[model samples]
Target: MSASPGQNLFRQPRAVFAVAFACVVSFMGIGLVDPILPALATNLNATPSQVSLLFTSYLLVTAVAMLFTGWIASRIGAKATLITGLAFIVVFAALAGLSGSIDGIVGFRAGWGLGNAMFIATSLAVIVASATGGFAGAIVLYEAALGLGIAAGPLIGGLLGDISWRGPFFGVAVLMAIALLATVVLVEPLPKPAVPTPLSAPIKALRHRSLLTMGVTALLYNWGFFTMLGYAPYPMELDATQLGFVFFAWGLLLAFFSITGAPWLQRKFGTAPSLYGALSLFAVLILIIGLFTGNRWTVIVCVIASGVVAGINNTLTTQAVMLVSPVERPVASAAYGFVRFIGGGLAPYAAGKMVDHWNMHVPFVVGAVAVLIGVAVLTTGHRPLAAADAAMAAGDRHTDPDEVAGEVADEFGGAPDAIDFEKELDHR
Candidate 1:
């Protein structure tokens, strides 16, 4: 069948913009809070480790919560979940603004993380379902927005922190409210997913060799990413404004790569090659930063290089998973996100201990090794999605007509009471 005209534009442009805008707002909140961590620690008379919990706790919950969000959205509908999640962020951000102590802030951050989990899971699914063409551009756009948000967080957070540590939290509350409104006014409800696979189904998919390996790869990268992003400025003894500049540079490099480099790299090199290359480069960059810590120029160069690597590597890794199982993209995204968070949660605490017992450089070395391992994991025996796509096409060409028909029916919401997947599996 011929594809519908203008379908590509209709599916992605509108919904993707809305989702990206929502992410921008929520991520801005996250970014804004980051630069204020030290101030908050001092203000609350808490240890640096305790204040760092602000990032760790939020990510931890969001990571765990994301695993279930896909199934929940399928049951409740994406629009409802999106709206409700934004509400959590908006309300809790305000609550965070009111916090007078470290514990209060940590609690609020965790609550906001729950909202983020909902937003991330629902937004991702909606974007994929709403997108018409292949997902390379769409994924890049999503990652770009994320990078922009991360970049903006420190700058804005620094500005607000200059006034008061409480200031950024208040701004976060306001931005989230604005995003909530935008989502309602600009974004349309996504078509409900046709087949709501059981939670067990995703678990089963995870057992697939490729999926399991990618999950581990994602976890290790997240551990490295959160470690680097979370701690890059701490040992430099930089003020908030200086740190903000560094973050801005980092985000700018990421956005540049996300917007420009990603498409070209994916197109020229193919997803797996681009992904593996990016991973290798990122590992090297992290090590460079750690090893040359005393050389200011080299450190700055390494930071920018790291941003480029992160943008390309992350986008391609996600693309790899989606290529293999387009239908399971949401579940896979959530599962990968969950693993990433588990890794993220562990990194800070582990790195914090190292910072206490050894030296700050210790975490950087560990993080570098972790990224290298991720590269190996992602590249080892990795059957590229292109190969998978080709094999499927060949399979379709060779398969019996009845089998193909049944596969189509099963995939796209077959006629009510018309097909049994169990029967089809038995036939296979």
Candidate 2:
């Protein structure tokens, strides 16, 4: 008898939910703090730039933590790391809620960021490990959940922040507890044990030219993306519900496309062209957003339009980055995550400074420039990644982990200390 068509998806539904809730919880903590920045500044008797550090503090720790969490995931196992991270998050969030002073919140925010680093880094690796056909479907699912989490953050945060600045953090802490329990009980352990690769391997991979470019691309995209998100509502004087609607549209659009639009585009244009097109359109969308500010209908339309491009851009960029270093995907992803978060970390400071010194639109202009820079990098450094992916794909036998490992080792050349081909080969 034939198996059900969607069996693979259900195979690890519980694990998926655990990770998805983690995504939602971590992001809720972030968004909850965001809308209240102005309030936080007033309450704490701080400058806007100082209040913005709440974001910078969290993202900075998360970025630094990502550098090692991927290595830790390999050693401890993805599932275990995920549970630990969520527990840390739950504890830290509750502490953050109880903070009596700005310095207290900053300290707890850094701790929260550290927990985020653990959660996000392991979450991606776990998804990839759980999937049947590598990360193809898993990426889409991850992105969809990411969109939902990001989309919900503003509305939920706004509501809670209005009631009390501390309310959102407490509410998110409650969510984190539930997530922690789900992560502990619901997710199945990996069938195969996680193979430990040496720490030096990831360090070496980070030095690769292709991976460096990918990191740069990620940083630029995030700089632009977060700048837009971090400061958009404030300049326009949007209420919490309106901000929620914007995020809702953003999530809904990405969910629709990730499930549908991306596949069709990939089928038609192939990865490279689709990638370039998505990046190009992303740049244009940034311009459109800057141009159409203050009109609710236009803002909603532009925000939603940007989601399709973002969904496609993320999936394709991840694929492109992975293609260049198939064996080192986890490490590469961590590096990319680090770069993206670094950019994200600085965004609030940069955008807030801009809004404080110049005007709100200044940040959007700067964001547009950042997106354009990413497009330029992607367009310029097109060859190495493409050539590498083609070389590996030629020898890789689809769905065969052994063949995939062999192909990757051969393409990247055998580096025992760097790759530990034996470890990868055995995992197959």
Candidate 3:
């Protein structure tokens, strides 16, 4: 028997693998600082809350800059954009390593964030444009990078941070430079969008009801996601190496589920129901973490369990947004990114302040509540979301992840009725 699309996960072209490898290294930056958070505070004479600015500066810049990544990529071409982004990361990460003050590191991290935003937004389009197996397979590949990076980041950071707080920063610079080289050598040049993406396009995409609804939902979801990442570590009181192990365990489960559990759950439950369940469960986990902030073991277990929820949500929402939005995929991506990253950026900063002014429980409670609010926000788009489900079920489309389609084939899983995005680009 021929292999199912699900079984054909690893059989990708070199370009896909190259970009995916770069993706893994790029995403590692997200969690690279986790194990080092405490170390920075102690070494730099900063408070835990001030150290939290690292996430804030990075994500806030990413949020704002990602809005224009597509526009920039369209003008410069994808390969150049990816290389530029990688170059920015390499420079800023090294600068951050050399910085003396918390404020200096925070500012350099903002530069790193801009690079990350450009790289991520462009890479997703490139991966989908080149991937094999199927649309679903491509997204799984992308998310796999995210999961692997998340899993490895803290462990590497922890190991490096043990030597010095500056270690992870230097490590990121080296790894990113290698990724830049691989991308240059291995990936073929991708065709730019025929018409340049206007600066106003992504913002205008928000006018679509489905896109807006999903964006708001993601905004709320990220509030919970980043809060866990930014503030949860403070309560654990583990050293850098121990913290790395805990998050490594968490990332392992996250990666495993991002590949296996999410697709299976979406298959059995459909996107909306699976998303509802995952968000609900994650909210409960955050609540548990909040209620037992003093119990290190309890907090650790809940954080690990959250990986499953994060994985499921990451895959499903990605497909759902692609499927439901009426706008072009790149536009939808940029707009969605703009909303979600803003929330992702601010949540941790807020969490730090909340902890200072209130109790540890306060931040977790807010995170849990934010997730619940996301679930509610998602409900408003039920009809369109249901339409997307119908579109997926129309063919043998239930198995794959994302499709790099345009306006004509808005649904993922590559239904027969949909137009091929690459072919469309070729014709144009």
Candidate 4:
């Protein structure tokens, strides 16, 4: 039997570490430029709307690319897909550093998004395939990696953006290059799937009402999430270094809660109440940020505290999405990824436009309203969520090792030997 999550979480092979390291660096790209948003706006003589395009370009591209990343991974093999994605990040990030204009940086960020999608598409599967821990253990480690990368990104970005806005961009290029080398050396080649994932699979997966309801809910909540991520920095008026520390605290809280607090809350409150509470809390936080836009301390506090709430919501919502669907974890994950990212990508630019036309409070209040609507959207699929909970309590999960191995290999890409994966996932 696999050890406890705490014990096995750190007891992984070097290959797991290698991919986990790459996962960290890859996720860092999500917030790597956050501290620099204001700096880039000022230095480049661009408007907040233009600077917001940095997020728009990156996330929108990632959103669309989610649809195809599985197809790419299935055909090319996992290691190749991971390497290809890493290579793309290394190139685009460096090019972004070299660019002279805001438009150029924004364009390069779009390219970086493509790489980000590729890496995300395969990294979790690689970890699952190679982890010494079983599936649950692998998730703990994966989520931990996610936390560290997210928490560290801003501190690193802050320190570098303290030097120059280009510093964060170049920093990622160098770090991802190191990660790329590690993957090439440590990770063994994975076999291609016997049945390749169709490009249209994720698109079709959304036809299910449970999946679509959850997807729309995710999208709306993300509107609030990214609105804060994209625009709140401007109102704070802090320099890059201070902004870094502020968001570092935020990321730290997010990471901590994702691993510990979220699970505890879910266990105690159950999924629906936990999600509703977290979502309501997050909306209130966004509304607070809007009401207190002129108060830097208020913005800073709400921004940091929102991390706790967001972490809870992130974990629960993800679980709910998987549980509520009849589809495999990956298809559901990809479908969810696509919709949520679209909301995340567009909110920043739209927030900026709203601010320029009306005021700061409008975008955030609107964002909070969007989240409240998400709470309503979530209600539409209450039966599915409850049934999922029932399924889990009855221990009705698939447990046959051969069945799991085949499913893992089929969804994540693997050779025939993957039938021996031995990692029976109770949950994705």
Error of 1 at 71 (Å): 2.0
lDDT of each: 0.70, 0.69, 0.83, 0.81
* lDDT of residue 216 for candidate 3: 95
Give the root-mean-square deviation of each candidate in angstroms: 5.7, 3.8, 4.0, 5.4
Ranking by lDDT: 3, 4, 1, 2
Candidate 2 error regions (>4 Å)? 1-13, 41-46, 100-103, 132-134, 191-195, 288-301, 384-428
lDDT of 1 at 272: 66
TM-score of each: 0.85, 0.85, 0.92, 0.90
lDDT: which is higher, 2 or 3? 3
Off by more than 4 A, model 3? 1-7, 398-428
TM-score, candidate 3, is 0.92
Give the alpha carbon lDDT tens digit for every residue of 228-319 in model 2. 66666554556555566666677667666765677677656665677778767876776666677656566567666887887777666765
Tens digits of per-residue lDDT for model 4 on 42-92? 899999899999999999999999899878887888899899999999999
Worst 10 residues of 4 by lDDT: 415-424
- Supply candidate 4's per-residue lDDT for 395: 40
lDDT of 1 by residue, 1-428 (tens): 11134444334566567778887777775557656766776788987677767778888988888877878777777888899899999888888889888888889988999999888877766765555543444566677677788778888888878788888888877887887887888778765556664665455545445556677887888777777766665655566676677777777787778666866786676666777788778877778767876676676667757888777776666656655532355666777677777787778767778778987687878988998798788775355444543343456322232343334334433423422444434432
- Candidate 2, lDDT over the whole model: 0.69
Model 3: colliding residue pairs: 136-400, 136-401
What CA RMSD would candidate 3 show? 4.0
Ten-residue stretch with the least lDDT total in model 1: 1-10
